[model samples]
Target: MTTSDDEEINPVTMLLLDQKDDDVSQPNNNSNIINIAEVVVPTAVEHQSYHLNSITSTLVIRQLPSQGLSFQLWPAATTFVKLLDSYTPSNTDPFSLTVTNAVTSVNCRQRLRILELGSGTGVVGIAASAILGADVTVTDLPHVLPNIEFNADVNKNVVGTRGGGVHVAALSWGKVEEMEGVGREYDMVIGSDVVYHDHLYEPLIQTLKYLLLGDGDGERVFLMAHLRRWKKESGFFKKAKKWFKVDVVHEDGPSGKSRTGVVVYRFARKDAVFR
Candidate 1:
């Protein structure tokens, strides 16, 4: 089915929209579905370690790469980890342009509550918890929770030493009950490559609205690391901008043959973004 320019598919009411099951799962030219890695490790379990130079510790995460995209590491996730690892109370260059004051406030409190959507392997959330000494809840599909829990377990000591913690939960986007279960008590929301597919745009935006636009006291921000892979992705941003004032906080220039740079965006409510 051909989609008109003005048509915005309601991701919650209709997930597949006009596309059939097979077509929806098929590899379109700009589809974000990636499944090309072939791992030969034991039971196809791969372990990735992130060294936090600031804290002088390492966080180890397990990945089920054979399972699919949700089980492996992505480019944007690594970017977020590096940014968070470099983040400090005095040097907040990563969050310099956008939400700087809010981040500083949270850092001063040392009680930053973070909720990570689509936590996947849980590396980004786990790293944030340890680096900022914040309590973080990393969530994803129910089926994907085991791995996230595993990673959180392995890093308990690392985060515990820093006075931070990690919690694993299941949060499927666009699900009202699930979103309610996750709650909106977070000072910051984070994700990496969460804007890949077109169908996921509206639902993800719905959840973002529920978190960022609702009645809140302090500054609420969504810091997302994204690697722009397709021109069609502009529509998602266009739709998101209506409910949020998005800004580029940090940009990772392309290296080697990698032409696309990973960008970290800070999404805040229209009023909160300025304040």
Candidate 2:
């Protein structure tokens, strides 16, 4: 029988219990029985680890129920991280200098300053730090900071070794005070799976307007990755286009199957148009 909503059962444990019960009811004389102690008990905390091949760094994350959606590693995050890895200097060592020089000139900095909004498990930010050697600030809601910090701490050594670091901070989009607290501008602003909520459209764009560099130089970049879920979610892109030029930079989905609707967009201020 299936368990009710109020009750939960581990599929592995349930299967083992069913087998034991069947063995007990059988008429055949059999002394052998499965050892209960051998069964592994599931833990409350879920631990996930990802290895970034480009930087040769590993990220360890521990998720909790309190943070809701932020507690788990999302597909968009993985996809963006893979995109970063592909562009990483290490992957193109011989041709890296040319790319690095262009990126540095655009940002006018030796190292990139990156800000990731709604950085749930800090995967993308941490990977950026380790792979690009960019100083990254991973920001999210106040309640999500603990796990973000934990993930940052676990990967601190790797980030440090790469000459990059991560800072965990609380940032609620559209909040004046919070927006003011974040620095004037960042070389690159990145986020994944942050556009799922319909109500956050205005605040998120407002926050982007405040933090994104509007110098009209096109030096700064805002990269966002999200899975297209609802038709209404397109409104975010529509609203964002008013202030920034949005372009699809990358796309990937399962092969020989329907499109997965995962896309990464690169946004930059429309210099001639921006007020």
Top TM-score prediction, candidate number:
1
Query: How many Å off is the CA of 13 in candidate 1?
Result: 32
Per-residue C-alpha lDDT of model 1 across residues 1-275, encoded as one tens digit per residue: 55455444222222111222221122122112434476434446656667788788888767665577788777678778877777655664647434356555564646878899998899899988888778999999999999889889988988886799999989989999999998998878999978877899999999999999887543788999887665678889999999898988899887433455788998888876352
In candidate 2, list every pair of residues with a backbone clash: none
- Cα lDDT for residue 42, candidate 2: 41
Off by over 4 Å in 2: 1-43, 89-102, 106-109, 213-217, 255-259, 272-275
Would you list the C-alpha lDDT of every candidate in the order shown? 0.76, 0.69
For candidate 2, the per-residue lDDT at 41 reads 39
TM-score of 2: 0.75
Q: Candidate 2 on 1-275: residue-level lDDT in tens? A: 54453332222121111212221121122132334579843434555566677666666666553337776666678677767666744444322332353356544445777889999889889988888787899999998898889889988988886688899888999998987787655667889989877799999999888766445446566778876555567688899998987877677663222234457887776762311
> Which ranges of candidate 1 are over 4 A from the true structure?
1-42, 92-100, 103-110, 273-275
For model 1, how many clashes?
0
If scored against the real structure, what TM-score would every candidate get?
A: 0.81, 0.75
Model 2 Cα shift for residue 154 (angstroms): 0.6
Worst 10 residues of 2 by lDDT: 15-24
What does candidate 1 score on TM?
Answer: 0.81
